[model samples]
Target: MEKCRFHEVKVSAPSKVILFGEHAVVYGMTAVAASLDLRTRMRIKPHKSRILVNFPDVGLKESWSPEQLKTLFQHKPNTEILDVNYVYLDLIHNFLKTESSDLRMASVICFLYLYSLIMDEVGIVPMEILVESEIPLGAGLGSSAALSVCLSAGLIGVLHQVQGYEKSIFEYTSSSIQKEVCGFAFLSEKILHGTPSGIDNSISTYGGMCRFEKGNLEPVRLERNLRILLINTNTFRNTKDLVERVGEKRVKYPDIVKPILESIHAISEQFLTSIQEYNQDLNEKKFYKILEDLMDTNQSLLTGLGVSHPTLDDVCRTLKKLGIVGKLTGAGGGGFALAVLPPSISGKTVLVAKDLLETKGYTCYQADIGVNGYVIEVVK
Candidate 1:
């Protein structure tokens, strides 16, 4: 390999919350996703001979030699393929020395697949990558998508250096790099999840807020960023399974499920409009009323779809007693629920709610919504 030519690159991508429309989004309904303050960070720099990956959050620490990965690349499936090549994935599973399926294994596979393909474009360079995250894994907070976006941005940053570029690839207004990052991250999401709505990767890449429907994304603007209380139920879920279950329900009772999905879609549309109106008029009371009603209705619709868990319901019900309304985010089996704190809400009220929930064995995080998406810095 040629001599290392650039300093290390550090990248971070924020976690996401699906404010409205979870499972129904899979059926072409619109979903609203916003970036949370929580994020996954990665540091990547040149190494001597082997490629190293360390992700302590999920307890994944593995290294691969260039030659071994090169051998695996030789068996790569057809370039015309649209989905993951199961043969190649099986080979990766065998190489990883694990038969059980889990997020840790999924992380490793996503890393290897992305690293190999991206490196092949800019030429192989021995590198070491270490990932640390504040986002909880499998908590419906877009943890995996954040990791994928961080890695994609970090690797592409390296690619820029290898091509003799001097400036960072990510800027607030750069659309091409943003699209590339989203594209790579979306592919990684597909590998981990057989089918994903692509909202997670898109939100992690673009940041701020977006309205996603049927593979199309439109940016949503807020006059002021929203404050949210993220509640982790401590119950992990399989997003793919939850999505599949919803699919089965739709197939079994389209009449029943289709209307529910359409209602959720209407809720998302109304929620978007209400937020925009609030942005224009700054009517906290009116907006909160509409938001609360929408949240309650959306949760009921999700419950009808059989995606809401007991823990999720408990969280919402508890919040309701305190005059706060919340709903499940992401895939919605049992992961995280979010409460949009009104701008006029008192700190004492929030603390009281947090204390009450923490006492009941739930975790709570105070975070801002619609924060910056992916960011990159040069490591000196």
Candidate 2:
């Protein structure tokens, strides 16, 4: 084990699911979402010259020099960097116009951008980071957002402790850290998805369930915990392409899509209200019904928008057979399917459901609800 030369810090960020409103959100519809326990975690260590990247779970590792990273960013102008609003895109562009691989370049640009503004208050330099994530990539679980939040919070935490900016970790709440992480996550998400509605990253960063309106995020309170099971179709969905397809549909079939969008918006409100009131009695029946309605709405709307993939349909059909209400999450097409497990469903039943899905080559996990967004742990 090459005597791991770096001290490590661990940070975890949550995954998200849109309970209601999908294709319609772009058309100004409201969406309800909750965070899942699936998380991305990163370990950072100080390094002199080399920036080492590792994804142990997938058996991938790479290293790059700072100069090479800068050049890489220059070549790929579409990369995203995070920092205070004061040092925005132009500053990053100027910095990147220098050499590197896509991943190294983009990661470094984002790391540096975050370090410059966040660490300037503390003062630190290049550190090698190894990131490991359990969250499935490109599965509409907000894995990228979780990664971004983890990186930003980890860097800021190290800088804060080193520079004496903060004395105690107890000073900041997880929710507070989530807010800061959201800023960087939002920036990174934009780089991935041209014009994301910001709901995915927001819910992933904050955890719990929320009602997202045009300009605000309202956290919903549930009386009893909700259990969700995520089934991965082992397929990737390109959010940007899906967004574009939805846009085209809006232009070509406004008459047909508009009503669906309006209905989604209304249902989203009811969903939020239901969660907030903790109506557990009606929740089992009503909640699943609402979820089914939302799924139907999403499938119909996404089908019209031409973003449904065969794999996604297969997973949905499999879940239906298992008696679980589920739908394709995020921009849809192909990715993961999220299913709501009724309280009446037993753990043994869930196992059977998982086995059936796996028999069909679908990967499934019992997702956690109300997970904490982001956290920084110091290992000295």
Q: lDDT by residue for model 2 over 1-380, one digit each (tens)?
A: 12223346777888777777776666666887788887888888878777676767656565667665555333332223442342354456555553323443555455555544555543335577787788876567677777777776787666656655454332566555666667767776665455666776787667788877774688887656677888777777787788887677667888876776777677677667666554545646766676567666666656655777888788777777777767777777777777777778888878988998899888888976766667677777
Global lDDT scores for all candidate models: 0.85, 0.68
Question: Each candidate's TM vs. the true structure?
Answer: 0.89, 0.79
Clash-forming residue pairs, model 1: none
Task: For residues 148-184, write the lDDT of model 1, one tens digit per residue.
Answer: 9998899888877777654548433378788888888
Q: Which runs of model 2 end up more than 4 angstroms from their true locations?
A: 1-8, 46-51, 57-105, 166-170, 174-178, 191-195, 279-307
lDDT of 2 at 166: 58
CA shift at 104, candidate 2, in angstroms? 6.9
